[model samples]
Target: MIKNHLSQVFYCFIITIILVFNSCKDKINSENQTKTEQTEVSKTVYASSVIPFFDQWKLILGDGSNAGIATEFENKDFFYTQNDGKDNWVVFKSPNGGDTHGTSNNTRTELAQTKKWYPKTANDKLSATLKVMNVSATGDATVAASHSVVVGQIHSADAFENEPLKIFYKKYPGHTKGSVFWHYEINTAGDDNAKRWDYSSAVWGNDFSVVGSDVSTFPEEPKEGIELGEEFSYQVVVKDGIMNLTFTSPNHETKTFTKNLLLSEYTTKSDIPEQTKKLFFPIGQDGVERSEAYAGEGCFFKLGCYNQTNGKSPEVNKNWCSGAETHGGDIQKQYADGNYAEVWFKTGSISVSDTAVSNDGYFAKND
Candidate 1:
């Protein structure tokens, strides 16, 4: 009987030891797995991580939702991050017909800088390395703004609220290459908005005035223009009321332009260019810029895909209206049909003039 009791006690002790050891081992393994998952999550990249300057800007999505502080924000349909096997990119997408800004008829998934400054008081600069991934594929080819997207701008915040600069990328359907251009809208002298016009200049290929002859007929493709998915960079620096622009791309010539904001280039009726007369005159847009162009007015920077395509009747304004197929503002249907614009930015920054920059930094600093 004594031997039997001793053997039973021993067996019980051994079983308890085994159970405790297994429990401890399972707990350790679970802890290690949790740590690994935490590390992976911490290393994940977001749109804010790609563009650190989001702290200084607010976002407006294509669905009309606005975000003030978007430190780690993204929407799969409008603004999000993408990895192209090489590196991650921040994408801005918008459909042709959807929610729009109160002051405009276009839809956008864009960032607007929160800080506004006067050109004479501050030297603000915005730079970016980007590519136009896609644009509205279906539109009236004769419309100049059709099938185009504005990637960057310096928008006014004062009277009339005109845009001082709008960098545009336009590609026609069935064309392999696209054109890069910029437009400077004049600050109209009077209250009528109908008289305002934009003066456009081309960085690569034809300017905004080069449109198709008719709705279906297309123009010759720009021989040296940029293609879809091609990378390019631009810098806009406003120093002492003078605007300086620089555009650079791989395998293309670098272009630079300068404009004086304190002085007016179009103070009289005859100061209009031939391109503007031919493009805007028939539409009764013949206004001239004020003497002190954009001076003392508060302005902010905007970056993203400001889709220019709309569903308006082209007969009303052939130059501005696109009359694209909208499918009654259905976003998913528009996306499936390639009736949207998408722009991807690899890197970008907005800085004041006095900001220090490393010599080998990606953003090109204008001395």
Candidate 2:
């Protein structure tokens, strides 16, 4: 009996030791896994990657001292000027328009246009960031109508044959007060008016001129409204002619849209509007006609702006007013000339912050 009791005690001691060892091993493994995830998430583009593009332009703008002119830089080709005074905000022609624009207090530096590179052929990967800041607005505004942004290609001097892997964001301005809506359109190589597409337009065919279908799919409009003074972030990927768009709010709520497309489907010879067609090519010495004479010359990128509909009566003026009285109306147009469109190889992955606003009103690191 004594021998049996001693053996039983020994067995119990061994079982307890085994249980404790297993528990400790499990805890260590879990901790290591968590550490690995954190390291992976921290790898996003820092200020260093973005600063060089704007540095030279900032020096020319004199740190935003001038008040009446809004200067803009292209990829080293054409410069754009807009009347940026109190009530006359118009884009004019300035000799040094591509010099400098505005300075951000965060880095205390001037801001310049970030050039986007288009691949030589289809199926090439292309990515870019379009940063929009509300410089001076008393009330909260939502980005309403769908605006177009140009990617690859050179000048509108030629036919836009090479289709781009395009991606853009859609803003939903539901019924919320002070909410704004923004739409994005992506154009490939072609005449200005020929390549333009709008999100609000219906998706009919694979025509490059038709909105959404030529580049990538846009998200469904939101039923509920987003509040005013709110900031939104969008990330997009275009790989091998496949495009994907993702949207995230300050709260980290995310949504994604993906589609597969062929480059040939978008190349069509449809009858486009005279104004739209003119936008396809550069304004030459005799600035008004569609100059297919300069075909294959390459087209650069351009950014278009539109107003959103607030519940307020149409009497309430909401359109973004500018000084270029000659071509003033619904679309606020800005173009980047071709010479500056240089290509750069991106090394690591890019991760942007959910909110562009920092405590001090500057772009903050992604939270």
Candidate 3:
């Protein structure tokens, strides 16, 4: 009787162990299924869909890859969106170095408006509300990394090889405030742009040329400066052959500047202003200008985080080519090492000719 009872208890113990094992296995499988479902559902929304003005814009990441104009898209390593407690914002990101387009050595994850228009059009407008997030911190304080990201631009589509406008936000390593500035690329009085340089204007802080005496030194922060994640808005209007630019923020003054894009303003070296002379003194870039600059050139607009940092030797040009860190194409390594630039756009809108056409064959193109 005792042996029989022991046998019965042993069998019961084995049965209970099998039941527990099966229960745990089922739970693990269930959790994996749920996680898979959540991932699938989250992919339904994308940058082009959630962000406004996406219909007129397409994305190109730092690696020079993109999904053809589509509403559903996401690049894991570059362009995407994230919520910041208050709201969701489209995020543009790029490594310090990666595959690039054109003659530019810098890499960016930015948006290009598919539409093309002349700067002389009756009225072409582009506007956006954005904030700077991060720039590569590994570059020389005087170089482009100092201004890690360019939020917007007016790029020439023809042979001019010109970016008439580039809006920039720059910050120092330990400073509490960054700067808001814009650059004016020379339309160069003639086709010989070999000697041209951008003329920067301060919107709320020191212009791009305000560098420290040495790489380790830093200039005084602007009396009225901008900080990372501080929201701001800008509007670019090209009407009557002139470009009107406006920058605004809640704490900063509303600043405006009007430039004639169709005509050449710098026709000669003497035409350069005193401020420009002082600013560009180091580079010795002062050169003669052509008579007809950027006239009759096709122009378009671009928006996103265009990184200004590179791995080039700082000894070559500490101001523009500081030896910033680059992790090759290892994106995960780059991000972990903080070798990337990031920008955020909360709102945006675009306007072209009423002709309903753009560079891409959309309604405006057919019209």
Residue range 1-367, candidate 3, lDDT tens digits: 9999999999999999999999999999999999999998876557766565777777777886654464667777887778899877888898887787556768877777786676656478889899888877666765644545788998876665578899998887777788888988786654476566778888988788787666677788777999888999999998867889999999889999988887777877788877667645466656655555666777778898888888887666545676777876677787887788888888888888863245653213212
lDDT of 3 at 88: 77
* Clash count, one per candidate: 0, 29, 7
Best by lDDT: 1
Local distance difference test values of all predictions, in order: 0.87, 0.27, 0.76
- Candidate 3 deviant stretches above 4 angstroms: 1-44, 278-284, 355-367
Q: TM-score of each candidate?
A: 0.86, 0.31, 0.85
Off by over 4 Å in 1: 1-44, 353-367
Cα misplacement distance, residue 298 of candidate 3 (Å): 0.5
Who is ahead in TM-score, 2 or 3? 3
Better of 1 and 2 by lDDT: 1
Could you tell me which 10 consecutive residues in candidate 3 have the lowest summed lDDT?
358-367
What is the model-wide C-alpha lDDT for candidate 3?
Answer: 0.76
